[model samples]
Target: MKSLTLDQLKALAQQTSSPSISIFLPTHRAGQDTQQDPIRFKNLLRDAEKQLLGSGMGPREASTLLQPAQALLDDPGFWNHQQDGLAVFMAVDDFHYHQLPFSVEELLIISQAYYVKPVLPLFTNNGHYYILALSQDEVRLFEGTRYAVGQIDLPEKTPVSMEAALRLDDKQKQLQVHTGTSQSGAGHGMFHGQGPGEEENKVLIEQYLNLVDTGLKEIFREQQAPLVLAGVDYLLPIYHKVSEYANIMKEGITGSPEHLRPEELQEQAWPIVESYFQQETKNAVEQYQQFVSTEQATDKVGKIVAAAFNGRVDKLLLSVDAQVWGNFNPETEKVTQNADRQSKQSNLALLDFAAMKTLQNGGAVYTLPQDEMPTDSPVAAVFRY
Candidate 1:
């Protein structure tokens, strides 16, 4: 099933007067042992509704009325629900007030499930802190001990007193850097006229560049995965310098690293990386559309019909709101709105005609909503030479 987006959920909530409900059932045998049958489940829900009505409550309050039923199922003393693996029921009133069941384990599973999918977060820093090893959809973090499996140890370089290291694991398809700064020796050197003068600044910059180069080379040598540069703005220039020497396909640096903790950073970065991948996919789709537009026989629909009649259309594009009805003769290049039995009777609807012509001639058809359609023209087709 396709994943739901925030926009889609908002639209759905607006359409339905009542909230959406989600139910989770454990597939493991322990939970299944006490699982209610489908028939019993329906009957219980019906009874709960009847009880609500008996108490002079409206149908809208049925869920509140059914709390007792849910409690009974979740009761630890009675059912040991948590130990046996629990189920979850959620009703989303709005985007913000989506309520989940009380089980921590269940909530964890739901959170992880959502995180496991590709997400696009607008203000993320980089993919390195976000993406997990091996899995395209998992996030890695330090607090949870979710470190990349083969993380390399980067000892602190003395001149700069910064710990910098690269981790590369090809089998996991992950590359990352662990970086931290130590107290500068010149913090109080100004009193003794030993402060980090211009020379010291140069030394620091050089050390930073060296660390970045080492990290970038390790990533390129191992996986050739896309580069994700994160951390403070001050550190971003170092990544830019490294990019000059590396074959980085894409890169981004975010403004804030919300969670000072490593684990939190990982979670925050996942969506940003996912968004980058989504944008790339959308670009590919647009390119294919441009290719079709370029190969079109003529700018007019009439010419497109002629090409279709000769089974020459390679692809077709049409407005979702378009209305067309016609039959065409391949040999004569003539189109008839209404054909009799004497003329070869064609049952192709306008939309179907365009699609069939394109497919039969080794092409594809795309339909877009009226608002989304690239052109106001009724129909367009690409033709083979």
Candidate 2:
């Protein structure tokens, strides 16, 4: 399964020649409700078909537009394993489906552009994290959100197996094992000594971990996200001692991850990451409040939309329960908004627009419940200018 990424989101955010259909629904991982997942998807498609026809599209054309999503109903395999929610976006030439980690309210938006606010939670600062699974034979890296985890392709130079790495020429030393440095995968006991010199086993395992950490140096350089390791208990501490990665989590998934699947790794990883995200959010809110009476921060939607587009927003907070229907003229930096949703699909969700702009300009975007917003406004920003 592919994780929902920033690039993919930007692609979906682009304007298309045809109307875009965005649909979201809660899903069940198991039980009888798994059967109901597709049924609900089918219902959403049906609603879309009606809306498409009502928009002056012919029946045949409408069917063709929805064919890709409709095909999912019969794929029992597709529905069998799902996360907390599902988000689908379909246009005349594009179709994408993401398995979400958190529940979403059932929603259908037939708009000129894709409705993306429903999925913004997954893209917030500290929202995307990584899981590095280590075992004696292989190293697996997964990109995950709050509830979903998907394995990512490791860089070629990275070691896939500890045994394979150790197999390199015995005469020529593999790597200088470092000691006393602190850091933090599937932990199998190939090195755990039950029958031999325990001291020798520790040295070999540390050497393997040193090589593994060196191999991952490139991956760690590009990321500031938290990393969770899954492996045996003893190996866990050894990894911590050799890792150079900045944000390795103190808690780890114990037991060999050799046979465990990505979802299983995610199940054990979320509780550990949840506290980190929550505290980060709490700190962000506190920062926003500190600047609320200053010129650096404001809840004014008009100023936010403009600042976001001009690369001035450093952090954006949007109300998950609200949308300000409007149009923003970027050239003039003017905002025109409606109090409620408008009938025309061309009307923009200004909050969504603001959030996207913030992300595009290398700023962070977070969704907060309406009651948690610093001011009573639906949108707020801490600006660079």
Candidate 3:
């Protein structure tokens, strides 16, 4: 599966194809459960074929459209290395799949466009977060969303290991190892006193962290995503001191990350980002409520959908349990809300469309339960103007 990226999302959003197929399935990274992944995929394909046939497509045409995805059932290599979920998109002229870091609800949609709402987290503040795992031996970097984490490679010459990044003399190299839990188990950034002692080891460790921060900044320069650090209890503060990245989270995972797999580290990292994401959405909701008396925000789906198409939406909060099925004509600024979703072939998930346009036009989108919204509406927005 191809790595998910913004370019792919944009391409999917800009697609003007009919009878598009989008499929999602929860997947296992490894273990005995891996065997079930292909089986699940096979079932989803069968379901997609049934949907296509029901949509009035000839049987051969439907089979041909699904052929690419059907080919994956026999590929064991693909099944063994999945992330937390999988996404597949197919159209007459397009076919691609993304191995996602977070689990997606099992779904399949055949519509005029791809069903993209579930994957929005990967593109917005809700899903775009970073992880910096530091240890004496190696420093690892990962980009994560709400539920999944993927390791990102540091640039060439970036200091990944204490040995590689440090200029320690032969004596220091051998002694440069160690960490210890506080006797009380109640401290952070706590260095293990091993070879020379805590004071001397801290000096070297600080230098190592500085190098990491500098290298990371090259990639984080234009990014607004919050970053979480993972390491021994004491090292977090040292890295924080040397890092100028504005979004380093105040909280972090306290442990050695050197040997932890990316998914293993994700188990520790998601809560930090999820809390951050929730607070971000909360703040946006408050802004919407505060500006409700003015024109800067609104909960009306009609106004919000139009604004999203014109790039006026600064942030959007869509409800996962809601759908306003309809059709929108962006060129004429025309839209219709359908009480019956299946009454017309052109009806769209209007809420999903707004979320897609918001992302496409460089705005943030959050999917929250309806009760948590700024108003009782299924959709809410803070405008750019």
TM-score, one value per model: 0.28, 0.77, 0.79
Note each model's CA RMSD in angstroms.
Answer: 17.9, 5.5, 4.4
* lDDT preference between candidates 1 and 2, better one: 2
Q: In TM-score terms, which candidate is top?
A: 3
Poorest 10 consecutive residues by lDDT, candidate 3:
185-194
Candidate 2 lDDT tens digits, 10-95: 67766564588889999987899999889889999999999999989999999998999998898999999787789999988789
How accurate locally, in lDDT, is each candidate? 0.37, 0.79, 0.80
Write one digit per residue (lDDT tens) for candidate 3, span 1-385. Answer: 3556665677888887888889999998779999988998999999999988887999999999999999899788989888888999999968999887678889988888888877776666765888898887788888787556766658676897877888777767656455666776533454443368767887888888888888876667545688889888778888889898989989898877777788787777788778788788778888888888889999888789899999999989888777777788888888788743644544587888898888788888877777776778889899999
Off-target runs (Cα >4 Å) in candidate 1 are 1-199, 221-226, 245-263, 292-385
Candidate ranking under TM-score, highest first, comes to: 3, 2, 1
Better of 1 and 3 by lDDT: 3
Kindly report which residue stretches of model 3 are placed more than 4 angstroms away from their true locations once superposed: 1-3, 30-32, 53-61, 123-128, 141-223, 233-238, 241-245, 259-275, 339-343
Candidate 3, residue 225: Cα displacement in angstroms equals 3.8
